[model samples]
Target: MYRAPRGTSDILPREQAYWRYIEQKVVNACQLYGYERIDAPAFEDTKLFSRSVGEDTDIVEKQMYTFEDRGGNKITLRPEGTAPVCRAYLEHGLHNLPQPVKLYYIASIFRYERPQAGRYRQHYQFGFEAIGDDDPALDAEVIDMAWQFFQSLNLRHLSLQLNSIGCKKCRPGYLAILKDYYASHTRDLCSDCKTRLKRNPLRLLDCKKPQCQQIANSAPRSIDYLCPQCDEHFNRVKRYLELLDLPFAVNHRLVRGLDYYTRTVFEIQPEVEGAQTTLGGGGRYDDLIEELGGKPTPALGFAAGIERIILNLKKQNVPIPPLPRPQVFIAHIGDKARDEAIKLAAALRKNGIGVIEAIGNKSLKAQLRQANTLGAHHTVIIGEQEVKTGTVILRDMTTAQQRTIPIVQLQEELR
Candidate 1:
């Protein structure tokens, strides 16, 4: 039998309630922060990510699903959300309308990576972006919004890891220092870190290999070398976060694995036993807009993996609101009863009553069983006698008590 491809899984009906709960909570939080929703194309010109996400990053270099279309254009399914949103901002001239365009999106992102427990080839992301502003307060606000979203879900033991990767001015100097430091320990570095040392030295800091991770932990920190402006910006962002009562730790080794990120970088991870998984992360990509051919615009954003959040919720045994139960089930026993049941079901639905029908089930016992399985509040029974008398029996499934009412009064009675 054919099956879903590797790194992907079907989101069956049984699991949809959890998704809806997360989406609704995210939407409500975005609204609370004055962030309007925006959606960009699922795929875009391959150059969009190559330029914005950075050429050396794993997402652009390996993970992106790139292909040539019928038009001979290099297109790629979006590996991440922020780049496409920024492309939309530049394409639509959002820069002219406002100083900072605040937007949020719950979108599907594609990445060709190993399908692990909370990771997938096709995943959903809840992302928020604020473009055209350089205020440190914007950085704090974006982090605050992410925190509030998790708080809304009642996710426990979430800790924020914060860092500063500096900007163009101070970063080059830091890279020089980092390269020199890594040069002395070249023999101990992983193969990837060796290449990173020559290409993008900062990436070495985020390497997951145990040896590289150990070296990174002792490496020189970017915060200590931040330019005056970057230092002040980082300090203000922390001060704002404290003012908002959001706690975070300065993780010197937390260099986000993106080329465009400058200054503030952070990740949110739950303190779980055995391999702490990051729920989400993002940073200030102040130069991304300009790199993508738009005028210079300082932007900051964050994205959370919906799948990871759901897994954490399940792990914590957090309660998710149950799906709505059908209020009325229409069961018919004869041809005339089936016809009458269809009409009654329509009328009840039009009047804002939730109705489920089992007109195909000829046996009343089977029909009642189906209603019980659905946890319906009430079951409407129509038979030859009821059809002839223009009446129907409404059974309260919970109490197992039923009563006959005139067909004309059924709608009002259900309400």
Candidate 2:
């Protein structure tokens, strides 16, 4: 039998409630922060990510699903959200409208990676992007927003890891220092780190291989070599986070894997044991817009993996709000009653009553069973007699008590 491709899973009906809950919570948080919703195409010109995400990063180099289209354009399913949002910002002249365009999106992101417990090839991301601002407060606000999102879900033991990877002014010096430091230990570095050192030395700091990680932990930190301006920006971001009463730890080794990031980078990680898993993260990609052919604009944003959020929620056993049940179920016994049932359901719906119709079931017992399964507040029973009398029996599923009512008053009775 054919199955869903690897690293992808179906979001069945039973699991939809959780997904909806996350979407609603994230959207509410975005609205609370005065962010408008914006959506971009599912795929874009392959060069969009190649330049914005960085040519040397794993996302653009390997993970992106790039292919030629019928018109011979190099297209790629978005590997991440921020780039596309930035592309839209530049394309639609959002920069012309406002200094900083605050936007949020709950979008599907694709990455061809090994499937793990909560990691998938195709996952949904709740992302927030604020473009055209360089205020350190924006950095803290974005961090606070991400913290508030996880807290809104009632997640526990979350820790914020913050760092500064400097900017163009001071980063080149840091890279030289990092290269020199890694040069002596080249024999011990992983093959990827070796190549990373030659091309993008900062990437060596984010290598996941155990040997590379060991070397990376002892390697020179970017924060130590930050330019005077970058140092002040980093300090202000931390101060703002503290002013907001958001606790964060300084992780010198926390260089975000994106090329667009500058000055401040961070991740919100769950404090669980075993392998560390980041719930979500993003940093100040101040140069991304300019790199993608737009005028120079400073922007910051964060994105959380919805699948990982759901996993953590389940792991913590946090109570998820149950899906709403039908207020009334319409069960019919005969052809005439089924017809009446349909009409009654439609009328009740028009009047703002939630109704479920089980007209296909011929037996009353079966219809009531389906009503009970649906957790309907009331089951409206119609038979040949009731149809002829222009009435329905409204059964309260919760109490298993029912009473006959005139069809004309059905709306009021159910309400």
Candidate 3:
């Protein structure tokens, strides 16, 4: 038997409660924020990601699942959400409709990586994007939405780590200073950080290795080197966040993994000691639209791993509302009763009642046991006598008390 590929697992029936819960919360949150839903293809041209997410980023350089299609075109499974949303925004002329197009998506993201707890090769993500505007207030709204989303989940002890990585203009200067500082620590740098120093210096601060983190800690802070415009933008974003009373801290080493990020970058993570799990994060990507051949458009977005959220929910012992299941089961004792049970099942379903009819000739006792196991609220028994009399026996699964009722009254009795 073939198993699911490495780094992937089946989301079994018993696991759906968590998924449904998170999905409902996601939909409700988006609706409250006026974010309409948008979905993009599972895969896109390989160049789309390389262009928008940056050539040197791990997503493009290492993790992306790129392959040639039948047409011999290079295609890549989407490794992230924001680029695809931006692509759709540009392709569909959404920019023509309004100044800011607020959109949300729940999509499966694929990457070739070593899977760990709560991380998978093909995992689902819930993300929302606000494209076509650059107001600091909008940034705050996006961050606030992210923070409040976790709050709505009732996940406790989450910290919002905020930072400004400066825009393209001032970032180069910061990178120069950063590279100069790391120049002396070349021997102490990790092999990856050594390469990052050459290709993507900002990612050095994002390094997790102990020694690299120490080097990043003492490195030049990006916010300190922001240009005048970026400085003002950072300040206003803070003021707006403060106005909303969001608890946030300025983390100097909080540069996000994406190259498109600029100015305000932030992440929300659980506050457990020695644990660095980020529930979600996003920041301003002011240059990405123009980079993708569209006119200059400032956009920002936040994405959280559904698996990670479910993991955290389980960790916190949060309660999840179970998905609705069949509440009534119909059991039969004979062929005539089986036919009647089928008809009754259909009638109940048509009347908007959920009923599970017995299948494949089970004993009445066995059928009732199945109903009890399924947590059915009531079981309707249609034996030969009941079918002849046009009546049914309804048993309360919880109380074990049963009564004979006319077939027409079954719906009302179940209700």
Candidate 4:
């Protein structure tokens, strides 16, 4: 049998309630944070990411699914949400009206990376972005939205990991220090790190290799070298979080995998592991709008993978929507009763009562057996005896008791 492509997953009925719950929480949180919902395409021009997400980033460099379209224009399935949001911001000229256009999208983003636990090639993301302002308060607000989202889900053991990847002013100075530090230890670096040292030293700190991680500990911190303005912004963001009683940690090594992020970067992960660990993560991208050919807009947002969040809910063994009860299973004995049973079922349905029926049954006993297997609470049985008398037999499947009721009063009697 044909099956779904590798690294992709189908969300089936049994596990779908968790997705509904997560979507609800995210939508509700977005509403509370004053972020209007917006939708962009699943794919766009390949240059969108190359410009916004960065040429050196893993998503742009290797993971993107790009191809030439019919007219020979290069297009790509969006590997992330920010670039598309920025594209929309410019295409629709939203920057014309608002100071900061706050938007959010629940989208399925694509990638070509090796799939791992809680990760997929075609994964869903809950993303948000605020453009047009460089205010630190907005940074704190976006972070709070993510934090409160976890809290709303009753998710425990989550750590608020925050950092500031400085802007152009101070970033160069930090890069200088980082390059000098890494250049001295070139012989100890991995091939990838050695190459990154020249292109983007910040990426070297983002490597997951343990050998690379060790070398990165000695690299420069953006927090230390932030320009006066960026430093003030980062500090104010901290002050806001503190004032709101939201706890966060400074992970200097958390150089978010994207180059667009500036001044604020963060991730929300379950402090507990063994299953429900990284629920979702996102950070600020202050330069993305400008990179996408719009005004130099400051933005901060995050996206969570639906699969991982649902898996985390499963690990906690959360209860979901209960099975619905079928109020009546209509059973008919002869062809005449079967005709009338159809009318009865429709009438019952019109009254908002749940009804299940198997028509033209061979025997009353057989029909009743089917009703029991279906877990029907009440069985509406129309045999020759009841049909000829303008009455019906209502059997309480739960109590095994039977009573005759007039056809017109069947609904009222059941109620």
Candidate 5:
């Protein structure tokens, strides 16, 4: 039998409750924050990512699913969320509307990577972007939204890791210092870190290997090298976060894994011991729009993995509200009853009532058994006598107490 491809899994009915719960929370949070929703296509010109995410980044070099289309254009499945949003902002002329346009998206992100617990090659991400502005207050609001989103889900013990990676003006000098520090410990670095040191030195600080992390712990801090403008910006971000009563820590090694980021970068991580993985993160990509061939536009965003969030929710045993199901199941006793069942089902649905009509021929016992399995609150039984009488046997599945009611009263009874 054919099966789902590796690194991907089917999200069956049993798993939809978690997805629906997370999606509702996302929608509610975005509505409260006044962020409009925008959805970009699943694929885009390959250069869009190669330029905005940095050609040397792992997403471009090894993870992106790139291919030549029938028309001979290089197309790549979206590997990350922010770049596409930025592309949309530029393509659709969102800058003309206002100085700051806030938007959010819940989209499928594709990547090629080793699958592990809570990690998949294709996953859903919830991200929001505030573009066309660079105010520190906006940064606080974005970070606040990220923190409050997780808190809204009843997640506990999360840490806000904050850092300023300086801007284009001061990052060059910081990279020089970082490369100098890493050059001396070349032998101790992993093969990946060794390549990172030569190509993208900032990524070295993001390495997770124990030995590389130890070396990074003592290496140069980017905040120390921030230019005067960036320094002031960082100070104001912290001040605004403090005013908002947000708990954040300044981590020296908190550089994010994107090339477009500058000035402020942060992450939200669960504080669980031995599993302190990041749930989602985004930062100021002040130059991304300019890199994408538009005028310079300052933007900041935050994204969280849906699968990871659900995993943590399960791990913490957080309660999830179950998805709404049909309130009434229609089980018929005979062929004429089944025909009546169809007409009644249509009438009930047209009246805004949820109904699950039984199909095929089955004994009343078997039909009721199916109704019980579906968790339906009430079952409406129709047989030859009921059809002839224009009535239905409404059975309360929970109490096992039923009553004979006219067919016209079924809708009111449900309400």
Candidate 6:
């Protein structure tokens, strides 16, 4: 009578093959890019997010899943991956290892926002981050990685959008322009956008509210106001992208929601997701390391929601992988045969052969039926008659043709 907890989903067995397929591609791609995998806890000190993600953002202000532990310590289920990864980088002293600490993560992140199709409170994210070194090539490399990651997944029609919001140099002035620009239309903007106008005017441009989006249509663009250094850096990033033969577009209004991002922000949006949705986005957050109590460093990275990617895949009618069929099924009769089947199962497992059997299957006919239902490629029958002879019968479930073979030769014979 009970249902799943709100805002959660079960990755059921019938659909797990596709999940594994996507995950395997990610793991392989990460290795190809020289990114070592690191896992941070699902939950962390609540203050980590409050400080790192900014207290004023919706993630901390309205969407975090914070709770008090029995010890009265406040902890929160991580709403995003970067903060936890940064915490681990600092705590474990990864900075001393090398110039750029390259890392990738595939994990579930929690947020307490409204759930909708392709959007969930609990969902998976595939993230990559590169810390250290401020070279423009690094920015291009991060953007390239995002592009290649999606391309490898066969996701098409995604446009890479890039921008630089300037460092401390001219950032405040741009914010002021944005504030001044929005102040005039404050009465026409959404209430949330109006409130954001007073707090972080830059956020008003990011608002998804209908009227806010309409109001921001003519807002001052950030790239036009970038200081000389920021302009040069952004140009260099674009130059590198061209060198790599990658295509991209400049979107000056591309301000990522997080406060840590300082320069060179970008997103990979599916052309089909339209106004209300995007695949994923991230940008340079050079000051994050300094705030995390590490030496000042320029960093840039991006993350994509795995669920949204899968959703798009489904929408495109891309094939979901078929469930794996057992390569061999062991059917046994009597105690001796059962014992032999158990030994055979272990040996097959050691050799990386997938086998399935009900250890307690009481009848030969029943076992065969179960084996056929499981779509096993072959059925290996061990009965008292065959056990005494030190041989087993291998039956092709599909063809109904079988041959008996010595138990010791079973592995090779099947192969």
Q: Give the number of the best model, judged by lDDT.
A: 5
lDDT string for model 3 (1-415, tens) is: 9999999999999999999888888998999998999999999999999998889888888999999999999999999999999999889888997878999999999999888886789999999999989999999999999999899988899999999999999999998998999998999999998998898888889798999888888889998999999999999999999999999999999988878998999999988753439889999999999999899999888999999888888888999888899999999999899989888999999999999988887888899889989999999999999988999999998899999999999888877
Candidate 5 at 162: error in angstroms?
0.4
- Candidate 4, residue 152: Cα displacement in angstroms equals 1.7
RMSD (Å) of each candidate, 1 decimal: 1.4, 1.7, 1.3, 2.8, 1.6, 2.3
For model 2, residues 54-120, the per-residue Cα lDDT tens digits are 8888888889899999999999999999999999998889998767789999899999998888778
Q: Write the per-residue lDDT of candidate 1 for residues 1-415, one digit (tens) a residue.
A: 9899998889999999999999999999989998999989999999998988888788988999999999999999999999999988988899987778999999999999988788899999999999999999999999999988999999999999999999999999999999999999999998988998998888788898998888999999999999999999999999999999998999998877778899999999998964538899999999999988898899999999999999999999999999787788999998989999898888888888989999565589999999999989899999999999999998999999999999898878777
Overall lDDT per candidate, in order of appearance: 0.91, 0.89, 0.91, 0.84, 0.92, 0.85
Sorting all predicted structures by lDDT, with the top scorer first, yields 5, 3, 1, 2, 6, 4
| Count of backbone clashes, every candidate in sequence | 0, 0, 0, 1, 0, 0
Kindly report which residue stretches of model 5 are placed more than 4 angstroms away from their true locations once superposed. 273-276
For all predicted structures, in order, the TM-scores are: 0.97, 0.95, 0.97, 0.89, 0.96, 0.92
Candidate 6 per-residue C-alpha lDDT over 257-366 given as tens digits, one digit per residue, 9 for 90 to 100:
88888889999888884443678888888889888788887787788888888877777777766866669999999998999999999999899899997567568899
Q: Model 2 reaches what TM-score against the true structure? A: 0.95
- Give the distance in Å from residue 112's predicted Cα in candidate 2 to where it truly belongs: 1.8
Candidate 5 overall lDDT versus native: 0.92
Clashing pairs for predicted structure model 4, backbone only: 157-271
lDDT of 2 at 363: 84
Q: Which of the two candidates, 3 or 4, achieves a greater lDDT against the reference? A: 3
The parts of candidate 1 lying over 4 Å away from their true place are 208-211, 274-276
Lowest lDDT sum, 10 consecutive residues, model 5, at 269-278
The segments of candidate 2 whose C-alpha lies over 4 angstroms from its true place after superposition are 190-192, 207-214, 274-276
Error of 1 at 231 (Å): 0.1
